[model samples]
Target: MKLSLFIFLAAAVLGPELCLATLHNITVKGELLCDNATVSNVKVELREHDTFDPDDTINAVHTDSSGRFEIFGEEDERKLTTFYLRIFHKCDATHPKVCTRATEYDVPEKKLDSVYDMGSISLNLQDNKELGRRYDRDSEECD
Candidate 1:
């Protein structure tokens, strides 16, 4: 009886922690701003990088009135994975970063402990061919 009780107590104490460590619900959140002003109604997407797909995208959440956006995802297949965030909106003509262009945020394996706040990502509304450099490079070569 004593041994069984000890075993039960040990599991009761350690089971939850072990479970929590194995799986994590990594949430990505951030704000979009253009020219120092909050951009609303912008479509923010979460692109996942896994062995099965190059850059599998999901969710098309629009920015709230405060220009904030958020998304939830599971851990990556590899230790170092990328969660690319592409933004789009009607202001494509004004904001070069708009129009489903890739703005990546690498969610490394070590950072997958809990919710990750990407902070305020600002766009200067400038045009540049090298906008999605990281994702572009990975697209050509991601195993």
Candidate 2:
């Protein structure tokens, strides 16, 4: 019984490491745009379908003033088979709205031997007609 318990414990710890060894480092670059223009100060998040929870967020990055961002993660054939980009627009100084419009990149399963560089993903913000009308009303009220 003691020997069996030891073997189980060892496998539990080492099994994950062994499985993750097949993963390669991947870099994804992308740009966030709003109103047909590049948007700065946007938050970008990369989530894998195998682990879609917040705890499984493989990589998180922010776009620069030019709306350019790069996210780095372990490219695992088992984990990163399907991934999606979550873009958030900082509308206010303290609030960030989740831009539902996002770009999904489907990576080839068999091509995990090397680093996969997903070049430039473009994201467009969701058009909120209400917000536009509210802005117009607020401006009119202020004037």
* Root-mean-square deviation per candidate: 10.3, 8.3
Give lDDT tens digits, candidate 2, residues 94-126.
212222223344445553434445544434323
Worst 10 residues of 2 by lDDT: 128-137
Query: Candidate 1, clashing residue pairs?
Result: none
Give lDDT tens digits, candidate 1, residues 8-108: 99999988766654334467788888777888877776666666656767556878999998887654342344555666533333343333344445665
For each candidate, what is the lDDT? 0.62, 0.55
Query: Candidate 2's error at 68, in angstroms?
Result: 0.7
Each candidate structure's TM-score, on Cα atoms with residue i matched to residue i, is 0.56, 0.53
Clashes of each: 0, 0
Question: For model 2, what is the alpha-carbon lDDT of residue 18?
Answer: 74
| Candidate 1 local lDDT, residue 70 | 82
Return the top candidate by lDDT.
1
